[model samples]
Target chain A: MIKTSTQNELIQYVYNELADDACTQLEAAFMHDNELAEGCSELLQIQNLLDTALKSPHQRAVQNILNYSKSLSLQS
Target chain B: MNTTTQVSDSALVSLYIAGNENAFEQLVNRHKNKVYTTILLIVKDTYTAEDLMQDAFIKAIHTMKSGRYNEEGKFSSWICRIAHNLAIDFFRKEKRSPMITLEDGSNVFNTMAFAEDSAEQFQVKEDTHARLRELIQTLPQSQREVLMMRHYADMSFQEIADSTGVSINTALGRMRYALINLRKKMLNSNIAYDKNLYSE
Candidate 1:
């Protein structure tokens, strides 16, 4: 089972925020740990959902921001 | 001017300051969806999120023009900070949860009709997407905010800490819980992890 600290480490690992040695250790652990691998898979799935489902915003919002930008003076 | 892909965000900001509004356009076109997605995750309303995004860009322009953008160089993160703060301000002013709202003020979840076992695979995919959206809405506010800021704003834990007024450890802790919570929720819902979900 993934401990609390490992859960935190998993977050860092998924985001590539972990340091070199810690990442290496985690990778090695994943090879021997079914629970760790499952946790990592679950985290990756959440990330995938977020990326694919939340990819775009409303088109009107895009136009509105562009229009608002056009009205501004950029001279500094 | 070089292609937007060839130029850096800092260079784009400099060009905008040099009176090329299209430089600002390039910046917006490059980062708009990200900014919008970040704001929408927090505000949970399309129109309000757009308004906050507009406010964010306006504030960004004003700050850059007035020569107060003192972030050293990370222009994208700087704008994200503005949007992040605006979203917090919106929630504080409204004093409500960020409930997902459909355009007609109806519940999107209530309309979901899961496909039968015999249905096409595409229909199941659509159902899963809708279910995941609903599940995201159920995440705790603290965890959800941290997850969104990290995911959408592309902020480091340190940057997220500075923006959200939390310790870096706290930010990281919240992200940990966010992932754990999402995993638990998905498992409870019987949503299997499909490798192709991300690869496709």
Candidate 2:
């Protein structure tokens, strides 16, 4: 049972775009509250998994563009 | 790797402005992949992505040729800004549906075979991806555009704001809401919220 205020602060903390004092407050809150710690942990995991899964496979496309560049150079 | 060949992007732009066409090719070669991939994720189709990539490069070249490019900023960011605007224009004019329906052969995950996992888990992950995509599509167009630029294109909040002509706070707020909405949607799906599930 994380407090609503603390949970919101923790979500903002994960973005790492918050000010230093806010980050310190989030760290202290996590240390004191089990539910907050667990929720933050779960959200971080979800973020990491989603980031990996959503990465587009564009290596082949990049290679194709490079090949096209070479052919254009040859023609010129 | 030829050290001299790796000229700074600004230098290449200057070269292109001096009527050196090869410099324009260098610029395209450097940014083609990033532009193509960013557009592909936004449009969610290859053909449109290809056309948009070409359009982005052509527009960049035209800008340089016309002497409108200022060397005061990052060339990559400027070109990406152009691509972002073009993608948004396409979205507005097309009014296309955002939902990517997972028909029989359309599942991107079908090619990967997970080892030792139950069919159930695989199905859950796939469903979650599809649901996330649909949810992203449903986002307010502004929020969706910001999310795509921030996450997929790896633009900073400032860059997103500048490119989309919105405030920095608005860009950050849109991303915050986008993630919150996505998390809510995931919670409602069959994929149970388990910290350990992702660690494996």
Candidate 3:
């Protein structure tokens, strides 16, 4: 099992900010620390899900803004 | 030469200031979706969010035309700050909180533990999308706004703080609480789904 210090290190690894070596260390830590592994895995999943779900709404809202702004420009 | 790729925000602002309306259009094209989505998350309604987004961009253009925009600030960030302020104004006028408070009164950490993890198995299925939208609707206005700024619009905590007049730590704290609350809602709703669904 990954030691406690290593498990803490894995927890501190921000998915977008981690270097390759740090990410690999996180992978190794996850292999040994089941609880930390599960938590990290779940959090990453949640992020992905949220990202996907928000994409369409984001696009639609932007389009609405663009159309509105264009109309305003024409009127002014 | 990929000229568009090389043009900086300051360059675009300069062009717009020089009376090139298309430059402003290009800037809006580049950042509108981000701005709109950020507003949508705060307002939680389609029509009002769209109106606020337009107003934000119009206000930015006015600022530029009036020679009030600072060259030091990034154009997108400046526009975002405008949008943020407009959203706050909206909430203030309505005399309502910005986020949907959780009815269960559970702590964020505990709620996260119970959230569903089915996004892994289904890969953005329609039901999953619906569930996510429903869960977001459950968040308080402040939490929803912070989450949208952080995740959808991809603004940093400092940017959110600058835009919302909140401290950086407060923005981060709201996002932290948002995630926890979202997780809790998902867990409560998805307990009947398969257990190993998220396991690779």
Candidate 4:
């Protein structure tokens, strides 16, 4: 069974935020543990869900920024 | 004018400081989407987010003009921090809850209807965003902030810690809880992480 600390490490591993040595250790652990591997898959899916959920800002926001920047350049 | 791809953020910063207006445009264009998305996630309103984004760019320009712009960090991260702070400041000033809650207190997800429209693809995209936002709103403030910074602002855990005045481990722990909490919420809520549902 994967411990809470291992689950935490798995979170970092899925995000690719772990350092090299820790990442290697996690991968090795996953190889030996089916449960850990399944947990990793679930976390990865969550990450992908987050990525899909993000919305692009409206074009009006982009235009507003451009106009503001132009005004600033003119004043300088 | 050099192509935007050819210039690094630092180089663009230098050019803008050296009075090249176009360079500043390139820099803003390069990172505007990320900055806007980052702010929008926190503020959760389109008009207010747009205003805050403009304010953020103006603030960045003011800092650069006043010789206060630190060149040590990535320009994108610098602007993102400004956007994030502006959103936080708004919440504080208005004394508004950052929570995206509805009237019934059952969470926004339960009220949403994922109806298929003529533009089926766009409908799916909107539904996915709605579902995700619901899940995010369910998270505690700290976890939500860390998740947004990491995913939307593209900040490292160390960067998030620095911005939030926490230790790296604390930031990492927040992220871990955020993911775990989100996973639980998704499962319990029956929110499928189907790629086909999101992809057009």
User: Candidate 1: which pairs clash?
Assistant: none
Q: Write the per-residue lDDT of candidate 3 for residues B89-164, one digit (tens) a residue.
A: 9978988764564324222111122135454445434445545666887788788877776666666667778878
Residue B122 lDDT, candidate 1, scale 0-100 = 48
- Which regions in candidate 1 have their CA more than 4 angstroms from the true location? A74-76, B1-6, B97-127, B197-200
Query: How does model 2 fare in lDDT?
Result: 0.65
Would candidate 2 be rated incorrect, acceptable, medium or high by CAPRI criteria? incorrect
Interface RMSD values for all candidates: 3.9, 5.6, 7.8, 4.2
DockQ score, prediction 3? 0.20
lDDT of 1 by residue, B70-137 (tens): 75747777787788889889988999856654333233322223334335654566566656666766
Per-model lDDT = 0.75, 0.65, 0.64, 0.77
Instruction: Report residue B139 deviation for candidate 1 (angstroms).
Output: 1.5
Quick one: ranking by lDDT, best first? 4, 1, 2, 3
Better of 1 and 3 by TM-score: 1
Q: Which 10 consecutive positions of candidate 4 chain A have the poorest summed lDDT?
A: A51-60
Candidate number that wins on TM-score, 1 or 4: 4
Best candidate, TM-score-wise?
A: 4
User: Per-residue CA lDDT of candidate 2, range B78-141, in tens?
Assistant: 7777777787688778997655443334654343334566899766555555455556666677
Per-prediction DockQ scores? 0.47, 0.20, 0.20, 0.46
Once fitted onto the true fold, the runs of candidate 3 whose alpha carbons sit more than 4 angstroms away are A1-38, A55-76, B1-11, B96-127, B140-142, B161-173, B191-200
Residue-level lDDT for A74 in candidate 2: 55
